[model samples]
Target chain A: MTIRDEHLRQALQHAPDRLSAPHENTSRAVLSYARQTLEKEQRVWWQSCMMWLKKPLVSNWQRAGVGGLATALVVMLIFWQMAPEKATWPDAFPEHAFNTDKNNAVALMKDKNAAELNAPLMRRKARATGAPAQEQTMATQPGHVIGQGEHQSIALDHSSPATNEIASAPISAPAVVAGANDSSGAMSSANQARGSGSQKTEAASAELSEAKPVKKDAVLDIMQLLDSIKNEGGQTVAARDISLSKLRMLKLDMSTTKQENSAPCLQMATVDASPDMETGYPVLMVSICDSSMQLINGVAEYNQQMQDYWYRQLQKKNNER
Target chain B: MGESITTDEDLMRKFCAGDMRAFELLYQRHERPIYRYIRRLMGGAFNAQADDVFQDVWIRLIDARLQWQPRENASFKTWLYTLAHHRTIDILRKSGREVSVDEGWLDDEPGSPWQSWPAAHALEPEQQVFWRKAGQRLLHCLDGLPAMQRAAFLLHHEDGLSVDEMRLVLNAEFEAIKSRLRYALFKLRACMGAYLPPMVD
Candidate 1:
């Protein structure tokens, strides 16, 4: 074994070293064969991906077009959800939305007196024709049990309809239209105040009781995100963090720069400097003039310096005279 | 080398976008490593069956269009070895079912038994024949290793997959891959009596 090992080492070194690595013809042939097979089979494999076209969740048509449509739909839906609500200035404000409602809501905010709180919840009581007025009035106010009974009755009667259920369960809470003095009346009144412009609004109203003001941290987070976006995306500085007051106070005589229907939009030709001068900050919409930006304070100081230079030159001439 | 489909991933990317010639380009590029890997894998096992399997491994790769998503975890090399390992296991697991645990050569410098042998410059042709015979014996010793270990050691030595890739190929744990490699080297050293003498002088 020792001699054999020694010889093995010698053979490796002595074998003329083959001048180069193997020609690798077989390797090439096998790989080429594989390539051909792959090319041939790729068609079938790609077909499997599309074979089940009927599944709505996984359709090539859906992937090619429906995915886009679904994405667009989701985006539009999010936009619709995020869109600033168009307030329908009601032709006439509903009677329920009178100042009385606001006052009542604020007053009953902490009031636990059921009777006093329920005062706003008066509803037209069902009565037989020609019933005595006194009886009808008494019937409307059944002290406590009748009110509880009415709640139970409403809950039983108006609960959501159970359809196609194994058991026709009268289980869920009914859509009970509360009477005038009900707490829910105030809630529904609140919902009405914030008009359900769309289903999202209605859903939002349902969640109104649980809603809280936007968190300061969340606002800070959003602002930070926007700042990073600006930094990374090279957005115009004028778009964010520019205190509008600083620019509006420029005291720029409109005639100095005014040419066309140019306003304060951030375009160049729109807010260009005249042959003499134009005093405007870097309105992005405005043309880039020497660094293309200025603050009102900076501009004012620049103007003062220019005036001083002229005045000094005039003073020197007078002294020479 | 015949109409090959040799595209490196970088090349495949160009080809994926309706480049017919891209496929052939990639085949030509990867032809050697892939061929050697298969050739070495099914050494004597190379019959009609192995020919089909070897060809299929390439076909499998091509069909995978795996070049599309060259993932971080499933690397191109790992994926290729993964296919190769599975096929080797399928071929060999039929009889000598014991899993061999290769103990050395996992992650270190190359130290084959041939390293310790006398330099060929000193040897004549007759001595060269003895060295050749010894090399053949080393292969026999390699054959004693577990099917996957032999395959892993050979693949790593020849094909140059990373240790992590070996883990993927073997579907074994990282420590296990390391030890398997260590064991293979230690055994090879023992088998090569010249390198690892039984009674040191």
Candidate 2:
């Protein structure tokens, strides 16, 4: 270093000596203040925490690790809340009941038989009440039939052998029947008769069970009918025709004759009618039958009339009633 | 007989442990340079006299004693100056006298006062008086320097801090500290040249 540089350093180092030093009293004051400060200082827990957080000694990576752990804990808590529960099915059914294919099929068969046994009672109850009963019955049964009228609907009860027999019969066989609108007393009496009829059905079912192959064929027939009807847009013959024993006999013959046929066995024609408007003629009389059926007596009466004439006749007939 | 020298870090650690003697020793060790640093750096700013800033630095150091740690290659002295440097710079900034270290004050015209003074050789008979006046003029020159440049100069020359230690004390980069020291020296020399003779090879 140059002499000038050395002199400059020496000059600067000695320069402060020319200036007045802090008084000795200042030192005493500072130390006494420090003693008092140290004695009086009291840090709370939060203050200590804040000091730690603000501490420069804590590295950036450590702070980052703490933040990341907190974020992960929050995310884990959210997922724990949103997670789906285990064991959603009812406890009455064992988890293993449907574990195997064979067990699954057996369970399903028992359910089907139980549903069939319950269907007739439900239908009887529905007919005894009215629209509300029909809706309740329909909720329990999968099969639905929309009638010709916009508001008329029927829930097919599989427990009735005649209805099942008609479902299994050839499409061209059963003739549509026109029945009088029965009063509540008539329906209650009919339900009583059906209750007695169910006893006979149970005996027939017992006999069919003795012939296992025949019972299996019957079940197959029912399943096939349901599948075909479902595939063919779920329409059925009117409820009035379904209750007729004459059509039941005709369907029994048709089912026996066409037992081997795999084609759709049931044909349906939906007739649209307004439930509020009373028809002068029976609802079945106004319905159009398929070409395969001979409407022998009603055709002559309806052939020469316009729709307005029938409507006028219906109004007059309703007035007389 | 060998006397064990207690390092500044050791003194600070003892002070943190409530040793008043250690604090007194530490305070006395740094008292003069620190007070001069504040006084000279603040340089006639109103209400920022050296004693006030000096007491503030010591009080801050005492209050934050528990937070002090002996970093590798850094002493308690550097930390103490760091506090003083920051506090003085804050005062300088608030008083609006904070000059940029990079300001071009070296381009003063030939008619400047320092240029008109008699050369150092002409006053060889009164060397003692001339040196005293030169030292006083050097202090004046220091006050005229930018706050950071003055701090850099004082930290280096007055406190014997190396460029690296000055970097820690001033919170500046190595190159920045180096440049500040260079500017400080150049300006001081230009101001001090009026008192010294041109060297003969």
Candidate 3:
């Protein structure tokens, strides 16, 4: 290096030696400032968490829990509202429902002995005529018992005068003697004569004998049940679960049973149809009654067109017979 | 109190890893030279701006410890001076002052080299007073040089940076850094010789 360059470098290098250093206070302050800044950065995580928790109303987690609970409650309420109502006693055993006897009658005729078949018809006819007839008390019998004193005859004293008049009607020997093969024909003839008002009482007894058995037997069985309870000093029957199958069996038993003529009870009338033997046209027999199981009404006349149709069918059936 | 035998880059790495003691060692090693560089670059710590710029450079160094690594071509000292140089220029510009080194300003009053040469002698009180006066005059002349020249001169002469290192710190081409240093030396020699001439050999 040149003398001038060497001297200039030496002078500039030595010049800084005379200048002042930074104050101790400023060095400490800058270091302290940096530490504070870094310390703040370090705490950012937990500080942010605390900030989130300080939010109004509730935290996000609690809102999720409450939302879940609300959704569950809504689902439960929807299912509850949509669920079916339990069947009430009256609905379970309605006062008037389609009697299933029509469906079972064919089975009964095919299954039972001729004696078993004739017994129910004879008892039903006897009760319908209101003669001094015996009622079968055995529960196995598909017929209702009429209790009167120590004997099993129904007492006619509690009945209205009209009922007493019915009870006092004479039983025709021809009706009592008709074979099961001729019963339906005899019943039809008696019904036709009654339509003319000449044989009303006699014909009504025959037709009603068929009508009252199903519903009246059920009512009488319930009455017989209540009577047994009364005989045991009227203790309340304990509640029990009646299964649907057992209920259906009770319904079948009630429907197949014959009803004796006695006190008033709930009644259900059924229609039976058969093809005329010769004409092969449908013949419909409809039994009519009031709610009291009393034969106060009758299906005397159909449409005039139907009467001619039915008369042709009946005459053809009689000729075939 | 013991000067750390570790290199500046190693100290910086240690500081980045949270060894504050290594940072303090690095600070103590470079603080005086950096403070002087900024002090002379802004005329002195007499101006509050010079102090502000001085502290800013050190704080930047501390703050940048985590990001600092010694590259193949650049030393920690180059990086340190680069930070100080940039901060000085920023303060100077923000204060609305231009940094101009008038190389011709010395030519206007050129005295022959021997006219102000002090006699060669063993170190004496009279020679010390003359050198002290000469040193004060050189510092005053440094203040008048252009900002880039003063920075180049200080990085070269005071911080002992090579021309290539100055290029890195000053962010100028190597030749530009050389020219700035050459011009700075020329002016300081002229200015100081006019005030107190060295004895001619």
What are the DockQ scores of the candidates, in order?
0.07, 0.23, 0.19
**Please, what is the whole-model Cα lDDT of each candidate in the order they appear?**
0.40, 0.50, 0.48
> Per-residue lDDT for A114-228 in model 2, tens only?
3345456445534544436645454245323222121122212234453443232221211121111122232232223223332322343343234223222222322333233
Candidate 2's DockQ is: 0.23
Which model, 2 or 3, shows the larger TM-score? 3
Candidate 2, overall lDDT?
A: 0.50
Alpha-carbon shift of residue A219 in model 2 (angstroms): 76
**Model 2: TM-score, first chain:** 0.18
Model 2 residue B42 distance off true place after TM-score fit, in angstroms: 1.1
Best candidate, DockQ: 2
Interface RMS for model 2: 3.6
Best by lDDT: 2
lDDT digits (tens) for residues B110-188 of candidate 3: 5565474763552687766656666777887876777888787777776778787777887888667667777877667
TM-score winner, 1 or 2 = 2
lDDT of prediction 3: 0.48
Q: How well docked is model 3, in DockQ terms?
A: 0.19
**Which regions of candidate 3 are displaced past 4 Å?**
A1-4, A13-19, A37-321, B1-3, B44-46, B100-108, B194-201
Per-candidate alpha-carbon RMSD to the true structure: 26.8, 24.9, 29.9
Query: Chain A vs. true chain A, TM-score per candidate?
Result: 0.20, 0.18, 0.16
